[model samples]
Target: MSLLELRAVSHGYRQGGLFAPRTAKSVLRDASLQIAPGECVALLGPTGSGKSTLGRLALGLERPWAGDVRFDGAPLHDRRGRIAPVTRRAIQAVFQDPHGATSPRLTCLEVLAEPLRAGSTGKAALRDQATALLRDVGLDPALLDRLAHRLSGGQLQRLCIARALAPAPRLVLLDEAVNSLDLETQALVLGLLRELRRRRGIAYLFVTHDLRLVKGFADRCYVMQDGQPIEVADPFGPGLVPPAMAALRAAILPALPGPRPLRQPAAANAVLP
Candidate 1:
């Protein structure tokens, strides 16, 4: 069975004046997708295209107005039943901003320990697990005493990833998780994610707008347009070869510098009024 499945799922937001009858602005329209165990699927799209919404749906943050979202053949709705505590630990997320994800008041040790504490694990075990996770993400165990505000953006992002892995989740949702980092940092985090997946057999739903990044990083890619998935393809396929999708492809490639203005022949050292 697919690890995660969204079958004909649809969702919308109720907006406008509350006094008047509110209208539901649909963001997802019968969206269907599936991710198998140990497979990393990248969801690519422009802004307002429902990529984040779809991630939320997969994480059981929002209920679909139609259809069903299932994990291991069971629906994710409350009526069907809440996800078991053990099952909940199997699905975790790392969002776009690490600063926002990590508590400013918490040190790295505290941040990583929180999940284990919540899981009722012993403090000694939590410390060992958190230290190991930090090491796995290429961070120094000594840095664990530093507060969130003291770390660089890249370090903070890695911390968030480590925290997500603390529960030993089988699937990790990365919702534009690396968008705010520099190119070097982005590459580092991406490499770390890939390595972790290989070593741990963890699956990922990588949502982002950079198709170029996905081209080389993802095994498969799904394109979303206006809240709907328009295309899905293998990274090596012609799915991104069409003219209509060219813009997205181009956006992902290394940006070229604009042409430099021509010099005015040095003006012969004369001053002009």
Candidate 2:
């Protein structure tokens, strides 16, 4: 069975002023996809293309107006009208903004330990586990004493990833989690994520706007436009084979200078739009 599956899922949002007639804007239209255990699938699209909405649907933060989302063959909707704790724990998310994800008042240790506290684990064990998780994410143990505000963006992102892993979740929903980091830090985190997937057999629903990164890292890719998925392709295929989605993607890439300079160019500027 697939680790996670979305069958004919559809969702929308109400727009216009609250007093005005609420116009329903459909974002996802009959979307269906699956991710197997240990698989890394990337959702690629431009901004406002509903990639994050899909992530939210997968995490049960938002429910689909139609169709179903299943985890290990169980429907994601609350059974008996209540979300099962076990089900909630199986899926975790790492958001794009690390600072927003981490509590400013909480130290790194407390942030990581939050998951364990919710998991019925003892305090001592939680601290030990949190420390181990932070180490696994390539953060030094001493940082645990520092508050979220004291850490760099990359460090906080690592902590978010660590916290997601604290429950030892079966799947991780990463919504542009690497978009805010420097190239060096992004590369390191991507490599670490790959290693973690190999070691833990965890599945990933990686959402991002960077087609280049998706092509290199994802096993499969789904291209979305205007709140709908337009193409699905294997990442290992021949170059630029997403013919149907090529124009959309080509339009987004900035025009490069002819005969690009080499010798290890500096990283591209960070701009999330």
Candidate 3:
């Protein structure tokens, strides 16, 4: 059974709207997809293709303009337009910017513990779990005292993952999570995601534009164009892919560039202070 489903969802944002016969610029039109337990699926598309919008829909952060969003076979939102606490905890997201994902004012330990406080776990256990989770994601417990701003992107992102996992979510939405990191950091984060999945049976929805990243990381890939899933193909299967996607894949697949020159971080080695 699918853990989450977006059934024929259509959504858009209002344009020129301050009372001028509001018009919506449609982004997702009849878009649908699913993620099953323990599966690593990807929503692949270039910028402005509405991948992030779909990610928000999947995370129950927003309701579609039309169609239903289901989690574990139930509607994600109630008639009151409120999401259940379980749904909120079950569907967590880690976005492109770790700096944005975590609160700069909070220490690493506080950030990780924030999610767990909603649970029944005692305070001491929460701290222990936070420490263990940090270590699991390849960080030192000492860093827990550091503010989120103190760590590099890679370390902070790992901290983000730990915070997301604190609630023991069933599905994780990695929305371009590695797009901001250096090549080495990206590789490490990807490996950490794989390891976490292997150990915890967690499923991942990798939202990205890099076909190279999707090609090796995801089991099933959905290529999006103009906010619709046009092609659903297996990354490893040669016969299943379409010719156009194949050609584009060939063009961009050769060398998956790491972080570009100017944007590259000074240290991506999971550095600690």
Winning model by lDDT: 3
Number of colliding residue pairs in model 2: 0
Clashing pairs in 2: none
Tens-digit lDDT track for model 3 on 197-233? 9999999999887776775678788877656876565
Candidate 2 residue-wise lDDT, 128-246, digit = tens = 88889988899998888899779988888988999999888999998999998998999988999998888898899999887656755778878875556655655334466555356
Off by over 4 Å in 2: 79-81, 234-244, 251-273
Clashes of each: 0, 0, 0
lDDT scores in order: 0.85, 0.83, 0.85
The TM-score measured for candidate 2 stands at 0.87
Model 1: which ten-residue window has the lowest total lDDT?
Answer: 235-244
Estimated TM-score per prediction? 0.87, 0.87, 0.87
lDDT value, residue 256 of candidate 3: 53
